[model samples]
Target chain A: MSERILSVLVEDKPGVLARVALTISRRGFNINSLSVGPTNIEGRSKMTIVTELESVEQVKKQLNKLVNVIKIVELDPDNTIESEVLLMKVSINKETQTSVIEKANLSGAKSVDVGQDYAVFELTGTSKELIKFEKLLKPYGIIEMIRGGRIAIQTKL
Target chain B: MTKEKLSGAELIVRTLEHLNVSTVFGVPGGAILPAYDPLYDSPIRHILARHEQGAGHMAEGYAQATGDVGVVIATSGPGATNLITSLNNALMDSTPLLAITGQVASDFIGNDAFQEAYTVGLTISATKHNYLITNAEEIPQVLLEAKHIATTGRPGPVLVDIPKDILNEKANWTEPKLEDLPGYKPTLEANPKMIQQAVELIKNAKKPILYVGGGIIHSKANKELFELSTKYNIPVVTTLMGRGAFPDGNELCIGMPGMHGNYTATTSIQKSDLLIALGVRFDDRVTANPKFFAQKAKVIHADIDPAEIGKVREPEVPIVGDAKSVINGLIEKLGDSEIDTNSWLNEIKDMKENYPLNYNQEEKGPLKVPYVLEELQKMSEEDSIVVSGVGQHQMWISLHWKFKSPNTWLNSGGLGTMGYALPAAIGAKAAFPDKQILALDGDGCFQMTCQELITASTENIPLKIVVFNNGNHGMVRQWQKIFYNHRFSASELTHHTPDYVALAEAMGATGLRMVEKSDVKRVFEEMFKTNDRPVLVDCVVDPDDMVFPMVKAGGSNDEVILNEDDLKNI
Candidate 1:
């Protein structure tokens, strides 16, 4: 099975999100990551859900049956601009401090939080760049890591 | 804008009146007492069922009989929980149903008060859509929207849970307005390209069959289906739910296909090259072990529910639209084009003659289930509504009865809920007072919800109920004898069985117990002549009688037992 990004448009009803989640979980399909926000249209919201499915058509058929779901369109991975924000707190020493700051500067990431024995780095980029940033920060000792999963819209032709 | 105030229960009645709902099958209890008060003043007829399960099945029967959205109501706790079986039944069979239940007052909800239960939370998974209305104002919008959801698209059961206090509270009422539902629009037309592909597939296949189901009745597409089947010269096979979909006496009809299905229908699908599945869900019973069902066939599935299209087996061409609409499209595309299926028809005819569904009444002794159904079919009118309870009797009627019209046969095919026949027959009789409605029931099945006979007798619904008394749970006993090595544990209901005649008489219904086969006709004539009240006939059938042509559970359709001797040959 391959991971497919499905962008769903749903009505803004109370417990509509729970309804969608229940439908997915009950059908035994795993949701890797998901982000929801109100769209330009009133009384409706856009949800970008990332899930690995055996058949995209089957999932589309099921989600479309829900009363709150308006439409589901599978966004092409190649024709979309997607990014995630990474928050990582790492332990460092005087020797590692210079290397960490230089790595952050080189990677275009910024230090968001600071403590005596830990410093948090915030990075925003494609999932590929975040993987590299994770590798560089691993040597210093990572205590915590959080990534806001991808939210996307199709780029204009 | 009139701001006239009304109680929650009043709003519910008004909304139902506005929606043109004429009848509701329900039982009143303490929690739902306030709602009943308003119901007494409304124009809608509220049928007082003996039990909540009876109410649910009656609603199902009403929906199946009239092709309208059926309604049922109950109180909290046990009352609401009793509806689960029929709700699941409706969900699986795609019946349009609405169940209203009373919850404990808002303050006593989680404290487990008397008759208190979390009706909404517990039934979320069992319904197509549900609502928990705590405020009185949400009643109108919730009721109307629930009706829309219940009747539109792939119809199923939806529940509305309202608190007792909410029913007591007063709320301002403007004209009923449905706030726009932005996300629930369904696709009504099929893609032309997909229809063309299906036509091409049907045209090229040498061996083709139309596997039809109950959705044909739901969409009222039997006329179109018959034309398409005749025009293409394809044989038709229906599921248990689809018993009345096609004319059973027609030349192209190959009878039912699945577990306990006819020999020709099952084997035809196995050997055919093309399966034009129309409005069928391909339920596991129809497709024995879905992994290998019709493995060689290139399927063309046309159904209203997209979720049902590829849920079990992927169709080569999926036309997602109403059954009548899709078949009309097919007829438009392939008009009067005859394909040479003579060889295939000949093979099916040979199979039908070789393994005909046969059971000798004299060899079996006192009475046979098939013989009883044959007599019932012969005596009843062509348009009579035959509602069967679950078990071997259900299969007997589904196999033997010749239903010439849609919605003439009503049974719980999915949930296999016993005690469905009697109450469902009551609902059918209520819907069609002019037409005859009969309940083909088993001894074990009749006892489950036979208390509803009081409702029928009181309400003047003269339903003819024939109970096949086999002295045990025939189906479970058959399985135990075959699969469990003759361990008849709890399967026999002879020792503590009630006197069915006495029971019926106590309930104000006519009771006729026939043990002799010679008295069948006279008893049926006398029973039918008594038009003022309902009649119950308890026919003494052979306890050892088994429904043959059986496909054992988890077994392939090819490995079917044709008869008693065939069982030994296998």
Candidate 2:
């Protein structure tokens, strides 16, 4: 199975999201990540879903059957701009502070919250860059971390 | 447009009248009493069902018979929850049905009020579309939309949940306008490129089978289907839902193909070179072990629902459109092109003659269900409607009855709900009061919803029902005998509780019992003679009789067991 992303536009109505999620899960497709937000239109919302599936054609056809769904388009990974945000809190001390600071600076991470022996950093980048940055901070002892799901828009409409 | 002040309940009745709904099936309760008040003065005929499930199935039966949107209503909590099975049945079969239910007052919702349930949440998956109407003003448009969504596109069930407060609230109503929905346009025209490609395949196919399904009847395309089949000389094999879509006696017709399908129809599909599948989903019952079904054949699949096009087995050419339009496109594209397949036709003819559906009746024993169906088939007119409950009796009717027109055969094919026949027969009789509507039910199936016989009698529907009483869930018993080494395991129902004839009499209908083989024809003749009131005939059949020409579930279609002799071989 390969990773697939779909951008769906649906009416902003009660239980619409439940309907979409139920339709997908009941069809036996495991969703890796999903993010929903309002669009420019007042009564319409956009959903970006990431899934690992054998084929996306069947999923598209099934989703199209929903009466609330306005349109669905697939985003090509090669032709799309994708990013995610990560919030992480790491423990540090005198010995490790220098190395952690150096790694954070190198990766353009911003220090958001600071404590006596711990520091919280916010990072934003492509999924590949975030993975590498995350690896660099693993030695510093991560206390907490939250990774936002991927959101994408086609570069060429 | 002049605005008329009306309550939400009155708006609903007016909207249904505007949609030309003359009859409805339902039950009344506290939450829905407001709507019933308006219904009391309306010209629409309402049949009070014994149960909410009965009402829902009756609507499904009406829709299946007339190709019209069937409407049903019920109250909150238990009444609404009871409609779940019927909604799922209509969803599975893609029947056009509308279910309206009353919810607790808007303020009382989510408080776990008495007789209140999350009707919309429970029915979301079972309906093609659904709405929870909390505002009184939303009634007119929402009802119109619900009917449109239920009747158009793929034709499935839709539900509308109206809060009690909304029904009682007054709203200013004007002539309603159907709002345009961007997401809900159904593709009615087939792609020309796909049609041309299908025609090319059809012209070259040596052994082609028209795999037809219920979409033909839903789209009213039987005439086009018949013309295409006879003109191209292609053999037609109908699925369970497609029983009456093609004339059974036609030379090109091979009969129903599925687990309990005819030997010729099932095998011909296995050996065909090309499948011109129209309005059919290759269901598991029909295409057991899809990997081995029609392995060498190229399928040209057409359906109104895009999701069904490549759902089971991938097709060479996929055309998403209504069946009638798709068939018309194919006919136009293949203008007078003749296909030569004399060898394949001869092979099919041989199979048909050698393996006709057969059952033996002992010189002195219980009546066979097939013999009973044959007698009914002979005694009934071509236009008579036959509805069946799910079991051995249903299979016997599908296998034996010679259906000559569309909408004459109705059954719960996908859901296999046992209690479907009696109530559905009531619905069909309501739709066509003058037509001969027969309900062929099994002993176990009859017991499930037999109480609906009172609804038929009270409404004076004049439906003729036959219960094939083998005293067991015959299909389950057949499976146990074949696969489980005859461990009966609670399938028996013959020990007798309430006698069927007595129950029929208590329900205010005429009752008759047929036990001897010689009484089958005469009993059916007598049943048909009584046209003024509902009649129920209890036919005591042999418990050991089984439905054959069967492909073991999920088995290859090529491995069909034609009879008990074949079973012995297995």
Candidate 3:
């Protein structure tokens, strides 16, 4: 089944998240990535939630029942600008530095900094792009990796 | 007169002020920014909590302590969700609280809008009433209704969910004056025939017992209860919530009756021929086993909630009304019945003598909780209030502490909430600044909401906290030791606890630790002498100690586990 992304706008207040999460839980919906942040409006905030559901229509109907929900939009990935960031630190010797730099540059990555025994690379792109970059760099000993979950914003009309 | 439009957020503040809510505990978030902006300049004081869950507990503590409605505000989504535990806590304890949360804008109601939640539906079962306001104009009426529902008729928590758009939108607002609401009427009068029948049963019964619950204090019927108990010479048994309903040292007072109840109290309840249960629901913890509780007795149950009248064991005479009013009626009907219970009182006195709360300890061992409680009772005035969190310490306080007046012992009885003591102590201190307030807390319970010590310090409320640092969930551990064959699974909690003295000093308060039993008196003396800042006495207790005379759930009240020797006699 294809993954669904839902954008929900709500008033900022305490206990609202609990109410929504509990509602979704009670409805047996498993949320994938739920991100909430303040909106441009002073008193409003928005939540971008992604979930795998049986039917998009059923999810839409359930979203409508939320008391604090002001708007709900099911986004199509093709029309939306979605990006995720990956911060990976890898161990590299002086001999392999040239090859690693070449590979990193090929993936549109930047060498952010170098530690005593490791070098950190910053990568920002779609989830698929980040995964592909990780696969190419797997030969180089990767020590630690931190990935920011997907955050999406719709493109202008 | 000319009027101006106000946002729903502004309306909520005005309504709260109209309802006489001077203080609220909450955390600000995106969904509730509008309300915070208005609140920034308002007369109401909002305490910002570190977590949304903390806000809920703080409100619960405040309400439980003051007997006034506690109010908590949180923004949409997670903020609202975090309050579930607190709401459930209030619901179980029957504490009156008003929880307000901001929701997503109305226009985005169903379109998968950000932070949108169906809070009202989620909270319906936990709250007495819940409202989701789509219109800004309805804020005033909704708040008033919430307060009214919360304070009247078996007081409990209520929730008000307002959409962000509604809060930001301009609307004409007016405070509603009438206290009455349509289709909402609470019973205040007792059933006359039932009251008469109860009086008759009380007068003729050879062994009669008066079982009181939190309802007596809620109804402010202590004087009436005392008068009736004294007039009829009937002994009284109180539930944990009803600890201070009767004078502690009263001759006819048996003790608290329930799961961890005193053996004398439970025995008195079992032996009574007539049970005049007033303002009590006979909760499972109190009754133990419904079928066998007060087995030989005919029950005359009087309560404000009609549903609770026959919810457990059917009452022979059920009077549905305010406890104070029904009790008053009972007193009026029994004008000088001159009912003597010297023999019954003697029997109770014998039971108390035989099964008194006793714990074995060396003279120089760690401080005993009961000793600290006894000292606190001796130090404070008769009207001083004692608040406690749920655990072994709470039961210890209920069993040992002496209360001279009603509503003097506030506890999270039904809810059994840990981390309730410190906040509750602050609330009680705030409610009655001049009166002494003490919090009896266990180590496990105290750490849960110890952050409230910051509130106590900042607010400068001189509340005393006596921490029974047993270093484990004592009650649960005790149960495992007894009933579970000492498997000790998750009950064993061994962690490096914070240095309470350093914690108190850091929080700008006085802290004392009593490791040796001999030092208890001196430490208590210092605590009682200090009047400037709140004091924390970390009294290290015996880890192996257990709260005895506990009746297992589903067991008869008579089936209590006393010290081995006492069990042999029984």
TM match of model 3 to true structure: 0.76
Alpha-carbon runs more than 4 Å astray in model 2: A92-98
Overall local distance difference test of candidate 3: 0.81
lDDT of each: 0.86, 0.91, 0.81
By descending DockQ, how would the candidates be arranged? 2, 1, 3
Best candidate, lDDT-wise?
2
The full ranking of all candidates by TM-score, starting with the best, is 2, 1, 3
TM-score of each: 0.92, 0.98, 0.76
lDDT of 3 at B15: 86
The interface RMSD values of the models, given in order, are 1.4, 0.6, 11.8
Cα distance off (Å), candidate 1, residue B376: 1.9
Listed in order, the DockQ scores are: 0.56, 0.79, 0.01
**Residue A144 lDDT (model 3):** 86
Model 2 chain B — which ten-residue stretch has the worst lDDT? B494-503
- TM match of model 2 to true structure: 0.98
Q: What is candidate 2's lDDT per residue for A1-157, written digit by digit as tens? A: 2888899999999999999888987898778778888999999998988877665788889899999999998988788888788898999998887778778878989988777788889998877888888889998899998888777889986
Q: In candidate 2, which residue pairs get closer than 3 Å at backbone N, Cα or C atoms, i.e. clash?
A: none
